[model samples]
Target: MNTLLLHCRPGFEGEVCAEISEQAALIGVAGYAKGKPASAYAEFVCTEPGGGERLMRELRFERLIFPRQWARGEFVALPESDRIGVLLQHLAELPVFGSLWLEVFDTNDGKELSNFCKKFEGPLRKALTKAGRLVEDAGKPRLLLTFRSGREVFVGMAETGNQALWPMGIPRLKFPREAPSRSTLKLEEAWHQFIPREQWETRLSGDMTGVDLGASPGGWTYQLVRRGMLVTAVDNGPMAESLMDTGLVTHLMVDGFVWKPRQPVDWMVCDIVEKPARNAALLDDWIGGGHCREAVVNLKLPMKQRYAEVKRLLQRLEDGFAERRIKVSIACKQLYHDREEVTCHLRRLDR
Candidate 1:
């Protein structure tokens, strides 16, 4: 494919592919990771089997991007969905739907999709809505559906039948797979919002330590130990044994809210399933108490105005951390692996 699709937040792609590559397993897609996260754009071209979408298996990211440059055709279809479980089955079997090139999104009021919605209903309509928002323009797409079937099992239903015949001279193909994390995170490429890996590598020196709140199964902890820092992973659930074996990762077995580092630490990383405001307040306490020099965490998002919430929480965090002269750099990305919430990477301003 000459074109590709990039999945991310609506406006922050300036730095997504690099962050993705930081943790991406070497086996999958192969392509250049370029573009901007500030515009919520990320494009990576790969000739591998899984199109790098499978990378979500290990890393916590915010978007599912197929770069437009890898696209062999001129047009693509878009869908609106909150989960990927329903889309993966069909995508694995179909040809037109396997790997995509350039995926985009559209909201309910999308101008390009007004006519496409006429043929859909119920869950199908919902899916279409999501696809419309994800496509470059809201219009009848040149792609086919490859999702698992429910009450609706027919393919090409969006058109006449099992096949959609276009002008032979035109080179249009369908995006093959469909998938989240706000835990199953949500990301829109139009926004260029994707996860960052640079912050994870920045470790404190001179006896500084840290804690991983909600550190179950070890996503954030993996990043900490790699930085050569000691981490007390605080959570009620079981942790990844590999992390436990690292000597640097300690299982605290406590609620992050009530727990405190015996003394100041280097960072605090949380992937808690709590309200955004609650998490923000907790970070404030950490900075207010001088417990850590920097932090990176994930905040689960609710259904409405997620973009606005990110802005709101960031303001509160900045102001709260400011009083203590704790300078911070915060990055909120709609990673490919994220379900609906955004990941926050924070650093003390003075760092």
Candidate 2:
């Protein structure tokens, strides 16, 4: 009777969880409960109960919830005998240690998530039981929005505390997915939201041009070409016919970093499979030598020391640009479709 909880990026929840199910079963756990859009939590009862250690080994989820299936997410193993109130007590560690967020699915038929929050409110608070995870003396709560497909939910959590209640119903697993881009990594498209399309558009003095490194199959280039910009796609491989057809792209049969642009372009885009410093230096020469004005690039992370590698890459770029008094903004995030890696946005200032 062990319970397992799961969480995923909002709009991509269905797809993410579905992918989780596939990944989980492959790792041996089975019989995952389907998510009810109305409920804040999704349940998985492992009749065989593979245990928490197993889940962690298999599922690379953000977090794993257990006990009462009030689980916010992570497919943890829960003993069936765990009580609801006791679960809340166990949940106390959540507010203190974990990054807790209240997820409400009500905006788009999110009544179920709200209902769970309300119905479980008593036991949940009681479960907190004077351990005092919440900050009563503090200011307003902190929250953010999460979405899956097109359905949206508000995520809130007590500041200084870990657990907060979801404000809404089970999110209806309703919205259809957008057209699939090749490779689940939609870093280029996701970048549009972090920084406005307008920032790139307006700030781009002229109809800017760009280079899409590793531009074969063209996921990154597709995004660039769609923006009405021309791209020099550098790769030995042929570009995707669709991207090539866009007429906004030029396939350059050459190494991306080694091949310098004939003249300066507005931007440099890369999703090349290479070491971080190599990519960093490539960007350095382009922006450093004033070859391009702005750039959006992806530094693929290897299995080990990913964060540290990225940190070094950022530091190097900053040091390089700073030496010349160049200004830039850098943003990084674990995009909905990203796996074990993060996407970054870097904009060299137009000083």
Which candidate gets the maximum TM-score versus the true structure?
2
What lDDT, from 0 to 1, does candidate 2 have?
0.52
True-structure RMSD, every candidate: 16.7, 12.5
* TM-score of each candidate structure, all chains considered together: 0.46, 0.53
Residue 339, candidate 1: Cα error in Å is 1.4
lDDT of 1 by residue, 1-351 (tens): 222333344443433455445435354445566654343334455456554434433333222222111122112233455333344333334333321221223222222332433333345434433654223332322333321122221132111111112211112322222211112121112112322334323343425577878877666566556557787888888877767777887897877899887778777777788998888888777766778766666677774655556667887887876666766666565444455566666656664
* Off by more than 4 A, model 1: 1-208, 323-325
lDDT (Cα) of model 1: 0.48
Local distance difference test values of all predictions, in order: 0.48, 0.52
Candidate achieving the largest lDDT: 2
lDDT of 2 by residue, 1-351 (tens): 144444433332343345445556877776565665433334455556544335544553322211111232232233334434444444444444222234443234344445544554555445444455533433533322222212222222323222222212121222223312454146444444355556756644337688878877777676677568888989898777877776778898987768888788877777777776777777778777887777766666664555456656777888877888888766554443454445566666764
